[model samples]
Target: MSQELGITVKKDQNPSEWYTQVVQKAEMADYAPVKGCMIIKPYGMKIWESIKEDFNTKIENTGAENAYFPLFIPESYLEKEEDIVEGFDPEVAWVTHGGDKELEERLAVRPTSESIIAPYMADEVRSHRDLPLRLNQWANVVRWEATDTRPFLRTREFLWQEGHTAHATEEGADEETMLRLEQYQEVIEDHLAIPSILGYKPEHDKFPGAKYTTTIETLMPDGKSIQSGTSHQLGQHFAEAFEIEFEDEDSETQTAWTTSWGLSTRTIGALIMAHGDDDGLRLPPRVAPTQVVVVPIYQEDNRDEVVEYAEEVTEELEEKGLRVDLDDRDHRTPGYKFNEWELKGVPLRVEIGPNEVEDNAVTPVRRDNGEKKMGQDREEFVEEAEEVLENIQESLYNELEEYLQENIREAESKNEILATIGKNRGYVKTRWCGKESCEEEIKDEVSAEIVVLPFEEDSKPATIQEKEDHIDGECAVCGEKAERWAYFAKNY
Candidate 1:
């Protein structure tokens, strides 16, 4: 491949340019005519489909049913929840005129479906038996973002699954919230091969009408924190706003506690940035569209023989329950096919050439570490290839785990925290006095906000009591007895 055709810029030297080239050259996605919209090509869409299938099965097993809601929300309905309305107003895209005529009331394209779904949920649910309504939808949402329009990351239009649930009690709602977050962790770690830190969002950073928000955060290759997923406890806030109540066992009307959680295309962006290398995208095996690509290597004389061997290998692998593909395109050279599949991030590649056919073996190449080895026999090759893919998945997770640990630093003083933020691009773990003023002061100074408080409450040191920390002798910013340690970072 020519330099212009493949990635011209090195990831370490110019990551932004390198990323743009990979996305385009690999046939993953392209910028649309609109400013902040992207067209996900077949290759990218296939990868997304794989991810969706994995999560869909897991979600269905958890007793959640798929459902769809209207795309438009009337202004009056949106205004039901004060916090949600205020939080989303700036980003909501309004549909005012209907063709040449002005509508009686303007409608808003949903930035989220909370307001639109709550009313219908209230209407559909009438009794205590219908208390825990767990429904999810995979759809597109529009938000008029003012800046940052990277494809799959900060686009104005993005695809995602928004899950809305109503519970009988506050404790039930809270449990559901954490359960969803745990599911997110499983998907991220097992399928995406990305490690994440589970924690609670700071009050100032919690999701808009949620009583509290729990999140799973992952560190990208650039040391920036990406919120992989979030689950919110809506606490009767929207229940009262929308008056979603059910007749209880006692025959008394009681408000339902609600929760909403989502994972978006942004996770795709994170997967690219986290595992992708200077060569190209490195997708985990569980979610790779073509887990193993078979490349046939042949010269003019042995072309048919080599191609036949490649087909046999593909069939064998497929029978073993692997997603296998045979690259039998005659026009392209075997070297060219290898480069293409590498750029597309196939987990493993099987090369069957004339020499390999004579030896009754195949050469296997691993994308993760670029390791090449000879397979003893057809069965051995298939088993080894499967093992290599599993290893790559675990290797990617281990690499990211180390990166996350290195990016987080413990800061004991205000100046130290500021200095750490300036030098490193990730979270700075420091003690806070539980004061808004102190949080705001740090934010103003370093442009960093508190992102999460880890879920392990007892894991906190003895020096910290009821959010009070005696270690630093004072809050990082306020000079008061520090209450608790929290992770602060500049977020996406």
Candidate 2:
């Protein structure tokens, strides 16, 4: 393929540049006029719509409802929650004036919606019968990320869904937090086809004012970990801040428990790094915008006949409920169309020519592994196409699963921790004292921090306590007593 029309760098050699090329060449997105924002093209928007539609189904089953909220939040609302203001102060963008008039109070561009949404929840949740209230908003949020700005990964303005919920008790809040994390894992793994590790963020790294935060973390081909999704158990912190009180069955007033969870377009960056190759993106069939492209091959002599038959095959696949496209452009050669579809990561391609039209057959090629089946009878290929798509999904996931398994390693000393991250840059499980100072030491030296303190082998309701109880070793940094496992890595 020519450099101008295709990926110019190998993914393994220059991943940062390779990623940018694939995203633009595939027509997924483009950089906006704003420094740290991106314009989502139609092809990129379709992937996000698939994620949104799929997540809506899973969350709606748990009594969650979608709602809209204002983009601007007042300064008083943020000050009401001390942690919200403190945690996001450096990143928060404020509007000081309107038109030519100085505003009485500043408005925050909403680094997050906790301060604004909590007050709304307090107004609605006033009784035990009004418990387990869940509200989700699909919106854009802006943070002033002045350095290391990249498309989708760390953009200043991006789209996401933040779910704010109120419950009667802490147990209900915990259940809600873990449930959302589970649903996010399904979307990331089953749809995006990436492997993940679900665990707790160390206390210092947890969301500000949260009782605790659970995260779904995934690794990239470059060995850096990505925080794909996060579910925070806010407990009574937000409830008390906003005065979300309720009357219990015993006629006693009690403070409600609250939780917040979110998954963003950053996961799309994970999808690109996990499955893309030098050729370009390798989207799984489940979420691919165009699952199959039917490319017709013919010379001018028999172009009409070949083009007509290719349409029949396309319609057949469409009848089988597949997203099919017939690339019968007269000006483009079959070779050019193949490279285009492959760059866009269509999971499968069907090629037809005069030979197949006369034989009443079709040839199917797999995008995941480039395996081509020759001249299958047309009647049998419809169901076979579905089977091929299913296999491509599995193969893409398995490739990442194997890579993740191979990259996670164990470290028991400070030098070992630094050495491991310096050389490999993947997850390094180390015996930790649960002290931020030790993490700071490694981070200062190598720029790697604790990404996760894994949950116990069998414990589920988002427990780091059980995990804490099981570890017995000296601190990797201080060599004092240690009681936890911390997975350290350089993250994006």
Candidate 3:
């Protein structure tokens, strides 16, 4: 493909520019007139819907019910949770008037629905029976950011699902938090085909008003980490602020313990950065909008036969439950069609020609690593396509796994940590004292922060105490006894 028609920058040389060109060239999104927002095109929206559908099923199965909250939150409501208000003050977009008239109480466009949803949950939950009340909303939130704009990565308004739940005990809330985090891990690994590190966010970086935050972080090709998803243990903080109390079994009034978690459109950004290349996006089979495209190669003399056979093959693949597209536009050359599908990052492509029609076979090409296979008979081709799609999914994930394994290195001291990060863009594993001061010191050196305190393998159920346990060695920066071995990376 030529520079004018396809992405001109290499993925490694200039990921930022390459990403912008790929997203636009592939028709996933377009820049909006608004400075910090983007318009999600049909292809991008399809991928997002696929993500939503998979995650919604997981959330519902966990006993959470979907609900909606108002987009505009009253100013006073934010004050109820002082930390939340302070944390979002800069990004909170205010709606000051109705048409031309000044409003009595200025409203803040929802940066997040916590303040609004917490009070509603307080009103609905009354007794122990309502103690574990769980509610979630699939909606858009506006956070007026002042950073450099990227399409799905960071925007003024983005789509996401915010889940809020109230429980009778800290144990219940803790369970709720980890459960959601695990579900996010499953989605990222199983569906999106991206490997991630799951653990706790350091104290200074925990979500505002949260007792602690748990996160699923994935490393992008740029040597930066993107927090793919996060689950927070609010621990009665919001419940106390909003008075979300319930009567216990003994009939005594008590405040509820609460937790909130979210997976956003940012995950789409992670997918693109993790697997996209100089050609364009390399979508996983599960989330790819058009997983397979059938292109027919024909001339006027054999166009009828070639086109007819291609349609038949398309029907056969469709019946097998694949997202198949038949690219039979009469004017486009086979080479052009191939480039278009590749640029769009379809996982598999099938080529049908007059020769293949006479031979009752079809050839398939894999996108993850351009490995083409010889033609197979029509009935056998269906099974081969299924296997190739599965292999592509596995291959993509394995490639990421290998990249992570090769990139994550142990650093013995603070200087080592700084040197390693400066030299390579990946995770640097090192011991830390678990102090915010020490973390800041390291950040000053390499601009990398503690991304996660990785979960340990043990027979006991994963808990905060276990996640916080120190792994080995002295603090990399402080020279004090280490609290834990943390994964540190410069984040996106």
In model 2, the runs with Cα more than 4 Å from the true position are none
Candidate 3: where are CA atoms >4 Å away?
459-469
Candidate 2: tens digits of C-alpha lDDT, residues 1-492:
666779989999999999999989999889999898999899999999999999999999989999988889999999998998889999999999999999999999988899999999889987899998999998999989989988888999989999999999888998899999999999999999999999999999999999899999999999999999999999899899999999999989999999999999998888988999999999999999999999999999999999999998899899999999999899888888899998999999999988899999988888889998899898898868898898899999999999999999999899999999999989999888989999999999999999988776576644555456576888889998887888999999
Give the count of colliding residue pairs in each prediction. Answer: 2, 0, 1
lDDT of 3 by residue, 306-335 (tens): 999999999999999999999999878899
Candidate 1: residue 378 lDDT (0-100): 68
Q: How do all the candidates rank in terms of TM-score, highest first?
A: 2, 3, 1
Best of the two (1, 2) by TM-score: 2
Instruction: Give the Cα-based TM-score of candidate 3 against the true structure.
Output: 0.98
lDDT of 1 at 212: 83
**Alpha carbon lDDT of each predicted model:** 0.85, 0.91, 0.90
Sequence-dependent TM-score of model 2: 0.98
| TM-score for all models, in order of appearance | 0.95, 0.98, 0.98
List residue ranges in candidate 1 displaced over 4 A: 457-473
Report the lDDT of model 3 for residue 32.
95
lDDT per residue as tens, model 1, 297-329: 888899999999889889989988999999999
| Predicted structure 1, TM vs. truth | 0.95
